[model samples]
Target: MAGFLTTHVLDTARGCPAQGLTIALYRIEGGERRHLRTLVTNDDGRTDEQILPASEFRIGDYELVFQAGDYLRATGQAGDAPLFIDEVPIRFGMNEATHYHVPLLLSPYGYSTYRGS
Candidate 1:
């Protein structure tokens, strides 16, 4: 899975996967955001499958939106206006057969992401 878009969410505050979190994938087409698909993280804080299959990958600007606020509210971790981030958007490009591992370390007050292997 080194040639696909994958993600994992860790709840730093709770020290576990941010399961049940909604993630949306989008691509910029004609200077606008087009909805590609949506997925929910599993018990392991990862998508059930690879987001962008290597065979169908293309070079473009892509976005991954994480609904952390909703997840926190639903999990009773915070209110509608959580102190941490609400939606986390990661923008990147796919120019070759490269694995894009975007993992999020989330807390009630902050979050961080990086380009993983």
Candidate 2:
């Protein structure tokens, strides 16, 4: 099998999937970040397609930036100014050609991520 990257966001505070959330993927090389693509969460809080398909997948460092602040504000979870949790960036590396799942469990003030199948 070939490797690819996928992700999803769940609104832990609301006890449901985080719809309409924005996600940006970046590839890091030579100590610099290069913008790859931007994706939006569907009704199920998942991208319609893999963020990084095998055709473009590589073994290196990468980052997935979730626009949590915007989603929080839209869902009325953000309070006042200076939100506690804004953009959530998860950095990791792909060392093998296999499936990679990075999921976010998010709330208004905190978030967590893990590798899934």
Candidate 3:
């Protein structure tokens, strides 16, 4: 089977899905990062489709940039200028042909991610 990548973001501070948040995917090679695609979170805090589908999947390093600054400010979670914890970037390697789910558990001050089924 071919491999693919997916992601989601949750607002830990408010205990709800982070809807309307922006996410960007990039492929890292050598020392450069190539932009792949940008997606916005749905009402369920997930992209409607795979961020990187099987047709474009490859074995390499990739990064997911979550634009948390704007979302935090819009949601009233950011206190002031230069708020702590703005963009969240998760980097990982894909070494096999299968499904990969990377989820972000985010808060106004922190975040976490892990491989999910």
Candidate 4:
């Protein structure tokens, strides 16, 4: 069987999908971070394509950096400096041959992520 990686983001403050949010996919190896690719959330707060489709699925540790401050500012958040939540990094492991769905529910001050479908 094959597996894939996917993600979703929601703006808790606005109580809606976090559109235009910037995120990146990084592969961690030997205590070092490797640059992969950056993606922007669509209208549904999801990447238009899978982060790692089955064809490219592999067992490893990955990080998704969500640009919280930028998203908030672009979404009409006023003022700057001392932002509670800036770039949020979610690191997770993948070892099973099944879908890995990571979803993020976020606000300016905090955020949360969990295994999702």
Candidate 5:
């Protein structure tokens, strides 16, 4: 699975999977951003499926935006005026056929992401 890109979201404040959270995938081409797809997290706090298949992997700059504010509001984890970070864009290169496991540790006020195995 080295050629695949995957992600998981965990709500640190709640200590559970951040189900129903919205995420988006994008690729930069010719200085224009293209919307690859939008996905909602499953009960396991993971995308319904892999964002990008291994066969379709390519070497380029990619971004993953996690809709934290809306998720918190809908789940009542945060208030309507939640000081949530709406988006977290992760820019990276697919230099080779490698699996990119991007995991997000999130809270109402902050979030963190990193390359995972």
Candidate 6:
């Protein structure tokens, strides 16, 4: 009965978890997007809690936005370099009342995400 959404981020370029990175979630309703919440990653590159609480989890489409540029820039590696992918947005849908774990592997120029445990 306990089901929710979660996420983890990794800085592939740096070979470590992306700490202090910012992330946001949005719910898509009728083609319009509504903001859910924004969180900064902790030292482990994860939010303190589930992104979507079990009580609020519903069957619908959602999008997660990662502030890749800021994360890269914060590391001081992207200095004076034009960011190729500033914001990485991932859109997905949920059809079951199960835990959705989306983890992101990222670099200054690219990122990848997938459904995880």
Across residues 1-117, which tens digit of lDDT does each residue of candidate 1 receive? 336788999999999999999999998877899888899999999999887767767778889999988888877878555346678888877766688788999887789998887
Q: How close is candidate 4 to the true structure, as a TM-score?
A: 0.94
The stretch of ten residues in a row with the least summed lDDT in candidate 3 is: 80-89
By TM-score, how accurate is candidate 2?
0.98
Q: Which runs in model 6 stand beyond 4 Å of their true positions?
A: 79-81
Which scores greater on lDDT, model 1 or model 3?
Answer: 3
Residue-wise lDDT of candidate 6 within 1-117, one digit each (tens)?
666999999999889999998999999999999999999999999999899989889899999999988988889757565778788999999888899999999987678888998
lDDT score, candidate 1, position 49: 88
Question: What residue pairs clash in candidate 6, if any at all?
Answer: none
What's the lDDT for residue 56 in model 3?
A: 99
Global lDDT of each candidate = 0.84, 0.95, 0.95, 0.89, 0.85, 0.91
TM-score of 3: 0.98
| Model 6 residue 11 CA deviation in Å | 0.5
Candidates 3 and 5 compared: the better one by lDDT is 3
Q: What lDDT tens digits, residue by residue, belong to model 4 across residues 1-117?
A: 798999999998889999998999898999999978788999999999998788877899999898988998888762567777889999999988899999999987778999998
All candidates in order of TM-score, best leading: 2, 3, 6, 4, 5, 1
Runs with alpha carbons beyond 4 Å of true place in candidate 5: 80-82
Kindly list the per-residue Cα lDDT of model 5 for residues 1-109, writing each as its tens digit: 3488899999999999999989899988788788888999999999877987787788788888888888887777775563557767887777788888899999888
Q: List the residue pairs that clash in candidate 4.
A: none
Instruction: Give the winner by TM-score: 1 or 6.
Output: 6
lDDT of 5: 0.85
Q: Candidate 2: where are CA atoms >4 Å away?
A: none
